[model samples]
Target: MDLSCFKAYDLRGRVPDQLNPTLAEKIGRAYVAITGAKKVIVGYDIRLSSPEITEALSSGLMAAGADVYDIGLCGTEQVYFATSHYGMDGGIMVTASHNPKDHNGMKMVGPESRPISSDNGLNDIRDRVLEPFANAPEQGRYETLEVMSAYVDHLLGYIDAGSLKPMTIVCNAGNGGAGLVIDELEQHLPFEFVKVHHQPDGHFPNGVPNPILPENRTATADAVIEHGAAMGIAWDGDYDRCFFFDENGRFIEGYYVVGLLADQFLRKTGGGKVIHDPRLTWNTLDLVKAAGGKAIESKTGHAFIKQRMRDEDAVYGGEMSAHHYFRDFAYCDSGMIPWLLIAERLCQSGQTLSSLIDARIEAYPASGEINRTINDPPKVIAAIEAKYSVGAKSVSFVDGLSVEFDNWRFNLRMSNTEPVVRLNVESRADKALMEAKTEELLQEMDRLNKN
Candidate 1:
């Protein structure tokens, strides 16, 4: 009944302490009760604690009179796929995404893959689980299902090998669940892959299995350099987000990947809508517009973007954080889709990854997405707003806070689960203005905090 396991968009915490079998069971019961779902599907990542949690959750769901479909050991998207694939009432994924091995979490979706955020049903579910209930339904049952192979088939269905160009690429799974996909992908795809940390080790002896960190990215970049690959790709624990490294061993901002994928998707399905987070890149907006497709910008998060995608019937949506969603996949984001399309683009253009993103970097230079610690983020944002609101061309609070000018823009937002403010600055190829504006904003944030 300790509700700390519930988070902003999912249920996540450390094992046994913040999370355990008892807690998972309670969550399952509460989820079924709140959603009124008669049947539910479940999946998990490659953590040692996953199996135990999955079993406990299933017990809870059955207790609540929900028929459970157990899809053993799969990525988060696979659960999303199953929820839509089997026409189930709801689904749950026991994963922490890219969180450390010590951490685990759950993501739930109602019918139609609609999210259960704190405002919608997560808080209600938490309240239900908080109260002790001894009696549960006795007429429920569970069935096992293996959908990984089917999920793989769906991934390949979106692209053709004949359209894929041959190139050497480095891929680092960071010892996460992506190894399963990489192992099968090397044999099926046309690219020559240089592998690093491809084995799934729950201990995460290499690192936390997140390509976002500079340390975790070293192996992937080194592999690209060593093999003289065209590029390097890496994934987090759940393989929902894919990061890229150019041939020069430079880590490309995921925002660029958003643009790259948008361009590719727009070319295939011209004039379709493309969704992107507002944190970084006007390049996405430009590319989408230039390609004759409508650009829809949303606040930064998977839940918000996915909701918008369904509402707008967008063909594709991507966030600078590396989550990519496709309309054909029931508005679910997959780490597998971005690279597949990139490969297709390379084949069509006969260009390498470096060549693909170089023109974008020159066209729309960025401040490289920075995160900073601040004791009081609101005070900093307030001060910035007060100072800039007088003359700013526009000020928006769609996600956190964004202020726009004639030729430059920046957004400073508080992290959902941390005491840090993430800042992203962009300009129309004016490097000096971007640096000066970034410094000024950081100095202002520091000055206000020290006060």
Candidate 2:
């Protein structure tokens, strides 16, 4: 019983060896035992091993006296959508997300589509998997649940579809499950979709669908330019997080998208809280305030952002890493919703994506996110903090060490799962200053690492 597949947020590991039908079934039963979920929603991604694993998981749920509503061959958000949409007791998505193709995993959520991560129920479920399971007094039933139509309708509800005008939009699914969704949404919109790597293939001929990787972006960027699209969008394997490319075929950093989405969502809500991560702030803070919305910072990661969204009753939440959570969608991240809202903005404002983003970039120049592998992340980060905090106007540690001056700020935080430290620096209306400060910080970090 190698349960190494269980992770901080979800379960992810190599197939068969670390995760297989055997372990999946146990996880299913353990999930039921821990959460007391009677009616569970089960879904899987476009992975090669997903069907068999999902079947085993459903069996375990059934054996534990929890009826299963199987939503087959969908992305992770679909599970999130179905659980809250139909008022299921809980939901589990069998997906590795953007992990390597050979790996598989699961994302679980309890009632109201709240995440069941390590601190809450995931650890309990993992421990329970070690125990023996008994057949329930009555077995739970299994039925295929067709949630696509309703789910699509829910997605379209997020935007003004009538305002969407004719334009060429590039969508590179990267052979992941997002294509299925785009196909469903295509009929409702006025835009002409330039589909690239559009088919849902677990084979991932275009390579794992993680558009965040610089190498994986070319296909979408190239297609956007080739088709002269208004904009381009790409998604990870499970499509929970989506990346964007402007009309000029340039990849837009997720931080900018966060600001854009915050502004767009705030307009619709009239005025509401917009939740954001601490790693990068000034841009989002500016946009959020300009939209007449208050900004709240949460520690990064889906669980933290989603929980914060629930607590604040936020209209929308976003991370520089591309996860966008919407309140109307049960505080769950949706790769689809962000793009539709952006399209609507484009149509209504009659502004190119680049023009909209460029102004924000000029207002707040950022170093993006830079990761450095260090032998001692804590020591290096602390030392950097000591040196940088001397004349800093403010310093805080909501998620990481953020030291701010009048016009510039930088945040250095250790990766939750790795020895790498990520650094992000930004300056108010000064790209040169931002670049110079970023270089200085990286050099200082490297020097500290050597010491």
Candidate 3:
């Protein structure tokens, strides 16, 4: 009822206070009213609070005269697949998606798995739920089905590994929903794999499986080195993003992976358009163009990226953060595609992961993306633009504030769910200039943060 639980992209908050069953029930009733769906599929993650919330949500849906199909414990993507595969009118997945354990959220999908962000339909749902708790409409029937295997078959359809050469690999599911997907894929894939922390432990005894953090990546990197494997792969809580470490235990930047995937997709589809986030994407754009494909740049975030992909009919898309989407997969981002393509490439070229991505890292040196907390994000963007936008070759305000010099560019965008502004700077293999410019921008941003 507080309504703050309705975030910019999804319904997420610090649990009970911001999100609870009372509100969850209201949300379910409101969702049915807004989407006008008679049947809705529901799925949830391994979070301790998920089961309780799912049941509460079901109660609300049934009260709203909608039948509920309980998909049971599953990852977010599985929910997406089920939503579309089952021909349900809509679906909801209870997850916070790599957020801290105490935090939980829900991601909803409509027919064709269309996302329901705040701007889309979440705002309306929020408004309806805030009005009052409504009476029960009907006792909707409930059904259960194990969807993991069906999801596996769906993912496998995107790529073939039967012709791939044997290579040792390491996978770390990071005590999240990743293991559920990886476990099924391992049995069918031909590669000799070494799995690290593949079990789904909600306690996250090994720490969250977020590869973006150095601490969370230790196990994956160690496994790659210890097993002397070709490479290692890691995923976030919902397994929607995948990151990698090369054979020597060196963590590869998400930018390079974007380039690798761009190249692979181009080869497979023969130069269709590709979408990428501007923060760490020039390399991907360059590769796409060289492969005779057009490149389209979207602002960060899966919601925006997928929208652009649908608009442009892009064959593939990637974010430096390791999210990959395929046209063949309904233009939705998947955490399961990257490693499969890597394995396919390794088999095709008989090359190690290092050899494949080495040239890309060297060709496009990056400063690695950084985030800065600021009191006034718009004021900071104004200050940076005032100081650096002069005489710049070009500037674009597509998602946030992006300024481009002849050889380097950076975008400063505020986080939708936090007070921090993310700064992503990239130069043409000029590490020194990138460092200097990064410091200058950070100093400017810090000056604004103080005011």
Candidate 4:
């Protein structure tokens, strides 16, 4: 086994080479062995390789004396929902999640849909999968299940159906797994959906299904403007993370969405704790405080965010990368719930999406996350820390290097899943300062790269 395929939070690698059916089967057996799970749930996305990998995984699980329940061709969160909602022992979803078409991976969770990350037995499973073991004398059985209706019902539970306005919503699934769910959901919604690339095509003919990239965002934005929709939403390959654009076809930074959702949840629940990542803070902090809710900072990554939410009993948590977690949804991130809640909020308040966040955007001007590929991430981070810590009011190594002053702050961290350093800067309603600092940081990174 090429252990490099294992990541900090999940398995992701180039397909057939780093990950394939053979490795997936071994992983499936090891998962059962590690968790002692008697009943396992398996699901896959729209990727061409996913169905074969799911079959191989199920075979291994059954061979290891564990019964398998297969929920075919679904999003990543469906596995989470099926596991926790049906009281299954564990679950795995075969998805690369916005990676290149040549790549594939798996996301695993234990009972109650708790993630099993590298720190939490993923490495042990990796090691165990390498050794040979005999199959159980009595092989377990496999069964097929349908979870969409129940899943749609759960999604609708997050908002009142009657509260939705007869507005037009532009939905661009990017030819990924989100289309299926959107199609199923439309039957129950009052809004008209302007669908773009709505079919699930593993070929990814419409692009790689990642709206976070600037190049991939134009389709949704254009559709929204052309169709005169009230809002636009785009999802990644597996539909775990969602990106948003306002009625004017302008993309809203995910940082602002975090604050927006935090405000919404606080108002609904009469105020509760909210968790956010350290990369971007001021907007979320101000909104959270204004809503009479506590704001807690957590390390970035789904595993860390979910665990922190569980520990704090937070009513809501959001990452600027578009992952939103809710206390009611087993403390797991869902791409579907965030948009539903936003829709409901717009309807209830009779406000445009852009109008809702315009003030907060002005109050906390930010440089959206920028990424640079470097030879040595740790050395670059150390250099940044050495340069900034001298004049900073506070410095934190919570996730990476976060230096804070009274008026400006920034966090530079290495991505867990990619070979790059990400930088995010924000200022107290000063866009010029934010841009100047962002440029300075980029120049510094360039200097280090040349050296």
Per residue, candidate 1 scores C-alpha lDDT tens digits across 73-117 of 878888889898888999999998788798888999999777788
Candidate 4 residues 281-353, lDDT tens each?
9899999999999999999988999999999999999999999999988899999999999999999999999
In Å, residue 122's CA in model 2 sits off its true spot by 0.6
lDDT, candidates in the order shown: 0.86, 0.94, 0.84, 0.92
TM-score result, candidate 3: 0.95
Worst 10-residue lDDT window, candidate 3: 130-139
How well does each candidate superpose onto the true structure, as a TM-score? 0.96, 0.99, 0.95, 0.96
Q: Candidate 2 regions off by >4 Å?
A: none
The clash count of every prediction, one per candidate, is 0, 0, 1, 0
Better of 3 and 4 by lDDT: 4
Location of the lowest summed lDDT over 10 successive residues in candidate 2:
204-213
Cα error of candidate 2 at position 47, Å: 0.8
lDDT of 2 by residue, 1-451 (tens): 8999989999999999999999999999999999999999999999999999999999999999999999999999999999999999999999998889999999999999999999998999999999999988988999999999999999999888788899999998889899999999999999899999999999988788888889999999999999999999999999999999999999999999999999999899898999999988999998889889999999999999999999999999999999999999999999999999999999999999999999999999999899999999989989998999999999999987999999999999999999999999999999999999999999999999999
CA RMSD per model (angstroms): 1.6, 0.7, 1.8, 1.5
Better of 1 and 2 by lDDT: 2
For candidate 3, write residues 1-451 as lDDT tens digits: 4777788778788788988888888889899888888889999888888898999998888888889989887878888888888888999999888888877889998887888888889889888886765665466777787777878888887676576667788988888888777777878887787878888877878876677988887888888888899889888888878888989998999889988998988988888989998776678878998999999989888888888999999999898888898887667878888788888888888888898887776666777878887888888898888888899988788778888887788888888778989998888877788788889888888877887
Q: Worst ten-residue run, lDDT, model 4?
A: 1-10
